[model samples]
Target: MKKKQQEMQQQQELQQQQQQQELQQQQQELRQRDLQQQEKQQRLFFSSSYFISFAAAVRWLPPLAFGEGKNLTAAAAAAAAAAAAAAVAAAAAAAAAAAAGVAACFFLRKEGEG
Candidate 1:
């Protein structure tokens, strides 16, 4: 009986070890996927249509703010500055929302897998 118990214990230990190894592998895969996602996001950020739109904005905004040929009045310049600030704030909020959505989806997927 003692020999049988030892055999059973050894089998149990082997199963536990295997389980631990599988868990480690899973964790490593998750980390690799996360890194890949971050790299993809970085690439997307630099190559996105939004960046093109931002470039167009940069090209167009100066003429609008300064006036094409006519001198910009002080009040008009202040108004343009205020509008630009509001546009920046809105863009920032949108970016934050998108980032939060991505994070939420990632965590939810992780939770489901766990």
Candidate 2:
């Protein structure tokens, strides 16, 4: 009877250890997921800020080019065209930057995994 009790106690302890390990593994996975989400958000924020600054520059510079005596209609049209071009360029650049960032992250993750 004593031997049977000892065996049962050992089995219970092993089960408890296994449960603890599983819980730890789950927690680690959750932390890793959170880290990945944070990194993604950071990349998005960086790209968006870059685009916003570039757009602001595009919007602000056309007036300077027109100077103090330029025709209002011509200036407005020029500004519109400049804004359109800048928007396209900024979008492409932002996309490229974001892609590069994500790729770099993937490579770093691979390295860490290995």
Candidate 3:
């Protein structure tokens, strides 16, 4: 009776170990798949060719969100870059207007002065 009990306990331990290994294998597979997805996303976002092609085609892209995370694509990044460029242009225009105003004040004559 003692020997039988010992053998059964050993079998149970072995079965438990096997189950643990199976669970670990499943977890590893899930981790691998997650890594692959992350790699694919990085590749899609950072590919220069993708950006070049997308840039060539977005002349007609209507107004859009183009925010990060929610819209994390090369096209979205290009849109953001374009917006930044536009903002810089607007600032430069404002500065030029201010400079012209200053110049006019210095150069233009009063109503009675020639």
Candidate 4:
């Protein structure tokens, strides 16, 4: 019984060490990929016309949408924002109604407010 227990403990420790090594390897790989991506982005940002084009596009996008077609994506975003705001209002109204009901049952019932 003592030998069997010792063997089992050794196997568990071995498995744990293997797992730790695998985890360390995975972390190292992720750090390397991230570093490579950062270097690529830095190189592109310094060398490409994309940076200037992006800046000019951003400067013009708002005015273009306001001036023409009512710009599809901006309209969609505005609609989504309005819908979210409405949902918030509806939730607030429901909460107020629930609170009123609870108050009417407890405090308001004692008076004439119920």
TM-scores for every predicted model: 0.48, 0.55, 0.45, 0.43
Better model by lDDT: candidate 3 vs candidate 4: 4
Q: Where in model 4 is the C-alpha error above 4 Å?
A: 49-114
> Which stretches of candidate 2 lie above 4 Å from their native place?
61-114
Off by over 4 Å in 3: 48-114
Write model 4 residue lDDT over 1-114, tens digit each, in one string. 999999999999999999989986886687577557655754564444344434534654675667776575665555565556555655655575576557545743563352
Per residue, candidate 3 scores C-alpha lDDT tens digits across 10-68 of: 99999999998998688668757755765575455445444554564474354334434
Predictions in order: lDDT:
0.68, 0.71, 0.61, 0.62
What does the lDDT read for residue 1 in candidate 1?
100
Order the numbered candidates by lDDT, best leading: 2, 1, 4, 3
Off by over 4 Å in 1: 49-114
- Residues 1-114, model 2: lDDT tens digits: 999999999999999999989987886787688668866965777677557656655665656676745555655665676567656766766686688679767866875686
Kindly give the number of clashing pairs for every candidate. Answer: 0, 0, 0, 0
